[model samples]
Target chain A: MAKIELRGVVKRFGENTVCDGIDLDVSEGEMVCLIGSSGAGKSTLLRCINLLEPIEDGAIFLDGQDISVPGLDPQAVRARIGMVFQSFNLFPHKSALENALLAPRRVRGQSRADILPEVEALFARFGLADRMHNYPDQLSGGQQQRVAIVRALAMRPEVMLFDEITSALDPQLVGEVLDVLLTLKSEGITMVMATHEMGFAREAADKVCFLKDGRIIEEGPAAKLFDHPQHAETQAFLARALK
Target chain B: MPHQQTAGPTRRQIFEARQRRKSLVIASASTITVVVALIVLVPLAPGWSKVQQSFFNGAVLAKSFPKLLDAFMINVMIFAWSAPAIAVLGLLIALARDAKSPALFPLRIFGAAFTDIFRGVPVILTVYLIGFGIPGLGLPRPWNSPYIWGSLALVLTYSAYVAEIFRSGIDSVHKSQRAAALSLGLSERQVMQDVVLPQAVRNVVPAQMNMLIALQKDVSLLSFIGPVEIFRQAGVFKSLMANFTPYVGAAIIFLIVTIPATRYADYLMARQMRERS
Candidate 1:
C-alpha cells in the first residue's frame, strides 16, 4: 500500500474552493514535490493530506486506512505524519533540543532517557550540536527551521510534509536550510514538499506535481515533468520560475 | 591607556541640577505662608488643639491595633478567596468570548454587561444593595446581610475588569499561532489550554497584577456593609475617640498591601518591555 493517498479531495472556505478534487499518491520512501503559484492550493493540498485542513468532500487514506472520515482520532494519524512549517513554529519558551523532544516526551509518552539519544543525533546531524540549550529566539531563522525539522523527525514519522520550509529564510541563509533538507533527502525519508525552489524540485524530487486552479494539471517523473510540462499552466509556471 | 573625554552630562551634575531646582521651587512658594498661618491660628482657636490632637494622636492607633490587625486579616482572606476565582473566571470568559461557536456570542454579551454594570455602579452602593436591599425580596438568608453579599459584589465587579485584561492578552496571541496549533493536531480545548492561555496569561501579568492591587483597596468598600473588617473597626474607633488617628492608621495598613503589589506590577512591566526591545 502507498504511504498516503488523497482521492478526489475537496476543501472550501466559504464559497471559495481552495482544493477542488486533489488526487495524489505517495509510495514508500518517495520524495514528491507539489509546485504552483500563490493561491493555487498547493499548501491546502498538503495540509489536507496531513489532516491539518479538513477535506469537505473526498477521502484521504493513510496506510490503507480511511482517515478522512469525521470523528477519526487525528492525533493517532498525526503521530505517523509530521509537518514542518514555513514559520518554523518552534515553541518560543523551550530550548531547541527540548522543542525537538517535546512531542515524543508529551504525546508519545516517551521518557527523556529514551528520547535523548535521538534528540542528540538529530541536532548533530543538522549542525546544531552546540545549540541544544538555546531558545528559539536565540537562534537564526535557518537554525530554527533546522530545529523544527529535527523536532518532527524525532517523532519518527512515516511521511513528512515540508510546507515551504526555506521560504522564510534570509536569501544567503536559504542554502543552509536547503542543505539540511538535502541531507534529509539522502536519509531516504518519504517526504511531500510544497515548494517554489524549482531547481531543488527538479533535482531532489522523484515525482513533480504542477498544481493550478486547485487541480493537478501535470505530474510525472521529476525530470520529465520539469523538462516537458504538457499543460500550458505547468509550462508557464516553469518558465516564470526558471527566468 | 588612551584618555577619552566625554561631552555628555555627568551623572552627578544631572542629579545636583535636579536637586537645586526642586529646592529653589520649594523656597520660592507657599511653605513660608503655611508656616505663618499655622502659627497665627494656634492661639486664635483653642479647639485647634482638639483637631490637631485628634488628627495626630497615635494612641488610638496603638490601642486598637489588634482590632485593626483583625480587619486587615479579613481583607487578606477576602483576597485569597476572590483572586483565584476572578483569575480563572476571567480566563474562561475570555476563551468563551473568542470561540467561533454561535453560543459564545450570548456569553460574550453577558460578560460585557456583567462588567459594565458592576464597573459603573459604586462598590459601596453595590454592597448596600446586595447586603441590605436584596433581603426585601425575601430571597433567603444568603441576601440577609453583607458578609456574603459584600464579597459577592466585590468578586462580580473585579471579575469584569479581569475578564477584559484576559481578553486583551488572548487577543495579543498571533492568529497564526492558533492555526499552527490546530495544524499540529491539538483540539481547540488543548490549543487554548496549552498554548493560547499560557501566552495570554504571560502577556497580561502586569495588568492582572494591577487589578489585584486595585482589589486590595476595593475591599475597603466592604466596610459599608458594617463588617468588623479593618476600615469598619477604624470607623468605630474614630467615632468613639472623635479623632482621625485610627483612620490614618487604616490608610497606612492599606499602603502596606498595595505597595508590594505596585512593585510587582512595575517589575513585570519592566521585564516585558525589555523582552520586546
Candidate 2:
C-alpha cells in the first residue's frame, strides 16, 4: 500500500487556476472521497497525485518520495499508481482480457503464462468472466468500467486513483462499478476517488472532503460531515448535491 | 422460425415488391435509351469512321499487344519495389511528424518539410528531377540507370502523400485512449506501439488502398526518363504503325488492372463505414 500526500498542489490551465494550493493526505488503505461541484478541482487534485497533469506549484509525494520533480521519469511513478477515468477509455481494438493483460505484460514484464491465471481470477471475481473475451464495443458501459478497474488492478498498484469513474455510466450500471471499489477497499488497497455519489461516499469513504472553488471547504469523517457540516459553503453545497 | 419464414410475404411486402419492380423497369428503360442513343448518334457523325480507324484499329492493337505487355512488366517491377519502400518510409515520416519529446521535435519539422516538398511538387516534375537530375551526374552505368532513379522518385513523392494519410489516421484516435494507455503504466513508446499504431493502420486502410492504385498508375510516369515502360512502349507502337490504336490498347491494359482495384477499395470503404456505424 502507498500513502499519497499533496503539499500546496496547484494546477492551472491558461489563466484559470483549477487547483489552488491544495493540501491533502491519503493514508495507506484509506478511501478518501472528494466531493464537489463541477470545476471545484477535485478531479484535478486526483490527476496531480497520479502525475497525469504537471503541477505548476507544490509537490506530490507517493510513499514519502517527491514525484513532482521535473525531468524525473513519470512512468516509474505511474506504474505503482493506477488511475481509472470516467469515460472508461478501454482500447476499442482489444478484448477485455487483453486490456487487462497489456500493462502487466509490457510494463511489469510479466510473461502471459505467469500473469494469465491471476488476471483471469480478477475478472471472474469481479463477475466479468463471460465478458472477458468480448471487445469493448461489445460490452455495456458498466462492464467496460469494471474491465478498466481490472486493468488497473492487474498491475498490483499500491494506490488507485479513480477520476469520476462512474460519471459516464448509466444509473443502473453505476452500482456495479461502485461495488468493485468497495471490494477493493475491503482488500486493503489505498484509493482516492472523485465522485458525486454522496450516499456511497457516506457509506464507504473513510473521510469525506467537500471542495468548492479549488479549495477544500470542509473535511471530516463521513458521518460527521454528513450529519453536521461545519462550513456554510459545505452545507449549501451538500444541500444542492445531495438532492 | 420455420413458421415465420413460411408466412413471409405479407400484403405490405407484396406492395413493396410491386413498387421495386416498377422502379426497376423505369430505370432499365432509361438506361437502355441512353445507351442506344450514344451508339447510334456517334456512328452518324461524319468523322466517326476515321476517328475509329486511327484510335481503334484491330490490326494495330493485335500487333502492339505482345510488346506492350512485355514493356508493362517494367512498370509492374517499379511499382513492386517502390510500394514497400513507400509504406516503410511513410510510416517513419508519420511517426516523425507525431514526435512529442522536446529532443525529437526537430524531426517534426523535418517531416513537415518533407511532406510539403514532395506533396507540393507535381508527380511528373519530381519524377523528372530525380530521374534525370541524378543521372546527369557522370555516374557509372548502374547509378545512371533510369530504372533506379525513376523508382526512387516515385518512392519519395508517394511517401509524402502516404505519410499525410497516416498522420490523419493517427489523429482520429481519441486523446482519452492515450491517457488510458499512459495511466496503465505503459511508457510513451509502448503506448504508441500497442495502442496507437494498430488502430491507426486499420483506420486508414481504404484511403491507403486508393493511394496504392494511384501509385500503380503513376509508375508509368517514370517512362519520361526512358525506361521503355508501357506508356513509352505505346508511343513506340503508335509511331511505328502510324495509328493511335496502341495507345487505346495501353488504356485497356491499365483499366484491366485498375478497375478491379478501385472497386475493391470502394468495397473496403463501405464495409468499414458499416462496421463503424
Candidate 3:
C-alpha cells in the first residue's frame, strides 16, 4: 500500500464539481507537485487528502487505513497528515513555539516538557530560533510560512501537504521559504505541493502533475514532463510559461 | 519691498484671535450655566446648619443605612452571580451561533429571543412580573429570592448584547485562521478552544468590559424587585427626612462605584485601540 492514496476522489461544491475523479498514489517519500491554474481543484484535492474538504465520492488511505469514510474522525487523520496553507495560518495569539506545540500537546497528548525539546529542535532546524518567542504578526511572511511548516512537522505526520504555501509571500521572501521546503524534501519528507513556481516544481518534485479542468492532463518524471510534451495543452501551457 | 508686504492679517494672528473668541464664549457660557444651576439648586442643597444637624447623626442614617446596605449588598450579590453566568451563556451562545450547527439554531434563536425580549421589556416590568406577578401563576414564587429573580432579569437583558459582542469578536477572527487550524487536523472543538476563541476573546476584551460595567450599573434597577438596595435606602431617607441629601449621597456612592468602572473601561478601550492602531 502506498503511504498516501486517493482513489476515484470526487468533490463538488453546490452546483460545481471541483475534483472530478483523482487517482494518485504517493510513496513513502515522494514529493509530488500539482501545478494548475487557480480553481482547477489542486487545492481542493489537497484538502480532500487531509479530509479538510470532504469528498462526495472516493477513498483516501493513509498507510492503508481508509480515512475517507464519512464517520472517520478527520482530526485523527489530520494528526497523521499535516498541511501548510498558502496564508500561513499560524494562530495569531500564539507565539511561533506555541503554534508548533499546539497539536502535539492537544491531539498527541504530549506534555510541554516532552514536546518543548522537539519543538525547539524543529524551530532550530527551520532557522526560526530567534522568532520562537514572536507571534505570527511579529514575523515576516517567509518566517511565518516556515514556522507553519515546522508546526506541521512537529506533529511528525506521515505525509505533509503544501497548498500554494509561498504564493502569498513577497518575491524576495519566496526564495527563503522555498529553500526551507527544499530542505524538508532533502530530509525525505513525503510532500504533495500545489505550487505555481515551475522551476521549484521541476527541481524539487519527484513527479510533476499538470492539472487542467479538475483532472490531471499529464503526470510523470518532472524532467520528462518539462522537456517532452505529449499533449497540446501541456505544450501551450509550457509555451505561455516560457514567455 | 520690505518684508515682502505680509498678507492682510498674518494667519497665526487670525487663528489666535479666533481661538481667543471661542475660548471667551465657552468660558462665559459655562460660567452663566453654573450660576443658573446653583440658583436653581440652592433650594435643594440642605442648609449647612441643617446638614450639621444630620451628618453623622445615628438617628438619620441608622433608620435608612441598614436598608441601603441591604439593597446595596443584594445588588452586589446579584452582580456577583449573574455576571459570570451571563458571560458564560453569552459566550456559549456566540460559539453555537458561529458554529452554524443546525441543531444549535434553536439555541441561537432562543438566546437571541431571550435577550431581545428581556431587553425590549422594561426591566422594572420584568422585575415586577417575575417578583410579584409570578406568584399568581399558582407555581412556586420564581422571584421569591428577589436577588435571584432580579439578577435573572438583568442577565436576560444583558446576555443578548453580550452574545452579540462575542459573536462580533468571534467573527473578527479571520476565516483563514479557522481553516488553518482545521488543516492542522484539529477537530472543530479543538479549533475553537485552542485557536479561535482565545484570539476572539482578546480582540473583544474592551467591549466585554464595557458590557460588564453596563451590567454593574444596571444592578441598581434590581431595587424595583424589592431588595431595598442603596437607591431604596435613599428613598426611605428622602421619605423620612423630607430632604434630597440622602438621594444625593446615594448618587455619590453609585458614582464612586460606576465612575471608576467607566473610567477603567475607557482606559482599557483606549489602550486596546492604541495596540490595534
Badly placed stretches (over 4 Å) of model 3 are B1-77, B95-113, B133-143, B245-249, B270-277
**Full ranking by TM-score:** 2, 3, 1
Determine the TM-score of chain B of model 2: 0.96
Predict model 1's lDDT versus the native.
0.84
Q: On residues A191-228, what C-alpha lDDT tens digit does candidate 3 reach at each position?
A: 99999999999888999988888888899989999999
How many residue pairs of model 3 clash at the backbone?
2
RMSD from true fold, candidate 2: 2.9
Better of 1 and 3 by DockQ: 3
Return whichever of 2 and 3 wins on DockQ: 2
Badly placed stretches (over 4 Å) of model 1 are: B1-70, B88-153, B182-184, B187-189
Interface RMSD of 1: 2.3
TM-score of chain A of 3: 0.98
At residue A205, candidate 3 shows an lDDT of: 93
lDDT of 1 at A231: 84
lDDT of each prediction vs. the true structure?
A: 0.84, 0.93, 0.84
lDDT of 1 by residue, B1-277 (tens): 8977779888799999999999988886778878888799775896877876886686777887778888899889887888888887777766666777676788877767777887798877887787677666676665566667778888877887888888888888887666655555556776677667878888999988999998988887888776778888888898887878888888888888789889989999999999988
Evaluate residue B150 in candidate 1 and report its C-alpha lDDT on the 0 to 100 scale: 78
